[model samples]
Target: MIDDSIRPQLGIIGGLGPLASADFYFKLTRITQAFRDNEHVPAVILSVPQLPDRTEAILAGHDGPLAPLKAAVSTLNALGVACVAMPCNTAHHWYDQLAANSRAEIIHIGDAVVAETRRSLERGRVAVLATQGTLVSGFYQDRMSAAGFELCLPANTEFQACVDSAISLVKAGSIVDAAVETERALDIAQATGADAALLGCTELSVVAASLNDVNGLLVIDSNAALARACLTRLGFGTQEARGLPTVSRPPGHDWPMRGSLAVLA
Candidate 1:
């Protein structure tokens, strides 16, 4: 029987991109309401930047990259975490396999966004700004379409290039340029008659909070959605999880990064 006195801890399989994982952690901290440190939800974060590139692995149809993620989930499960959340959107392509390999529940970030989008918007065009690999995988497309929402994407290769460039800029620590390119893509979405935009990439989510409204359309940040989902699943309320504090830059290495793993208890 599960111990009722011990609170459930969240396990994060991160480092698909270091910055995005850090951003998600920051959002998780700020979104929760806690007057003292112990009142906040406990989390175990495993950041493995050395894990093979998700996009490359997906395009190559190789299973090598999945090994590290599966291992991380296993480690978290061994630590007795109740649920696991992977901040990387592209990694969700292998969500089923990862979930199967672990004893703990894996929270699907894509599903969280799709649910939030459906609840927020009754029926209208939803723009998806994501990585090329994510777009090619059709992960969001399949889910959003089935949810009865019209999905709009970058119109051409040039627009797609802009989205890719923006993501790269964020990874390279050029947030200003990243925001500019992201805004350009949002403008394209607005021009295409999208009623809302979904920041489908975690890197894009890092910069999404700073973007101005495009033609008065709502912009959904996947990281925030995942954070709220984590809180709610842990029995926290979501009413105060509405907005995320501004993150000017990616978090430092104080938390685990690259090749190491740490359990925050």
Candidate 2:
């Protein structure tokens, strides 16, 4: 039993892909430094896997998928949640509209990731691993570039397809194959000389944690960044919420986002 009065509750609009939603929830629990259950942040996760595919809707110029997302936000708002975090990066293409229609403040996961990158890496060439819709939408590229960070992406269509395959595998509950595909994308990022890589897709973030550093290039999980931002907004210090050991690196070394592969709660 958790006490809501002591802390504001968080609403999660998840199920863009069920595994990604579960991954985000697991990361939220693991990252929080809670001695007891009540010490952890209370979250209401509305996982609707049946929600229409965001990328397909965007590519096809259809607004049908946005309806369910809008409804979900409205539901969370009516539940009296202090804020809402949607883990799906591609779905953020409809962020402004969703935020406008919902009463609860919708936290921009990409914005949070950009802020974290600035804080952690200052300004550097960053690589992005995301879906075609996310890349085509330029969500991360526009925001990160506006903040003075150069962005790198899969150079060719083949690499782009590889990234998409990884995301799809994760969605289909194929973690092992998803990891292999994700690693291939990371290799491309490394070859491009990226200072750090952003796992811009929530599904990619699920497998990214299992991968080791690629030639010293830090892999930042956008989901973890969003989780940290949520905790910070809820009055927890970033360091306090992240109880992991810090690595000894050179001055201003890029810090890879921390996450794990655990059963979804």
Candidate 3:
């Protein structure tokens, strides 16, 4: 049985790009479904927006991201957070090092997103829209494929541009533009004839509702999936009730769409 007094505190190592970090925290709160004020989960957010660009570091090799990541871990650990979660998909490539030096439990956002996608969707063609680093790492494709799903992707150049635009918009605080970039990514995924598009980036959730034109395509929002997972871990919402509040279904809704991270692998 879980001990209420010993509930673990959640630590967020954010600013992997600032917007994603904020979105993850917001979703975590919104999905908690706390019946009493004291039931709220404790969270420690370290938003160091100056950290090395995760995608840039991965593509360009270890050109100095270790320091910031390590610092993030240190800050959260000092704050007594028992588990840490990073919202960026690309950052997961360096997760081993981040976890190696910390006693805090680290949650793999990318893996969580993929696992939820598998459980919610039938094993079939899945396309992931993310930064070049994430694609290059084969993080989503490799993990999903290992689970018996055929992972599809956009044309090389198109995928790169999508990643670039999403990051650029999010950093600029142009959330509406971020949503547009997500739609563009979905288009690229559809062009590849994918059954669905996995929004492998956390920023997409910040403006997920702004995307209203994704007709006949399933869109998976990883950040939202993570929120649900966090809530489930805290015993807040049930399996079916653990996600974004329901609204009027947009037109032509055929597949599932959640704004939380889904555990993939």
- Cα RMSD for candidates in order: 9.5, 8.1, 7.2
The TM-score values for the models, in the order shown, are: 0.87, 0.86, 0.82
Return the lDDT, model 2, position 80: 78
lDDT of 2 by residue, 209-250 (tens): 555456677888888889988888887544423433222334
Clashing pairs in 1: none
Instruction: Order the candidate numbers by TM-score, best to worst.
Output: 1, 2, 3
Scored against the true structure, residue 50 in model 2 reaches a CA lDDT of: 92
Cα-based lDDT for every prediction: 0.79, 0.78, 0.71
Comparing 2 with 3 on TM-score, the higher-scoring candidate is: 2
lDDT of 2: 0.78
Clashing pairs in 2: none
Clashes of 3: 18
Clashes of each: 0, 0, 18
Q: Which consecutive 10 residues in model 2 have the weakest lDDT in total?
A: 256-265
Q: Candidate 2 at 143: error in angstroms? A: 0.7
Those runs of model 1 whose alpha carbons end farther than 4 Å from true positions after fitting are 1-8, 241-243, 247-265
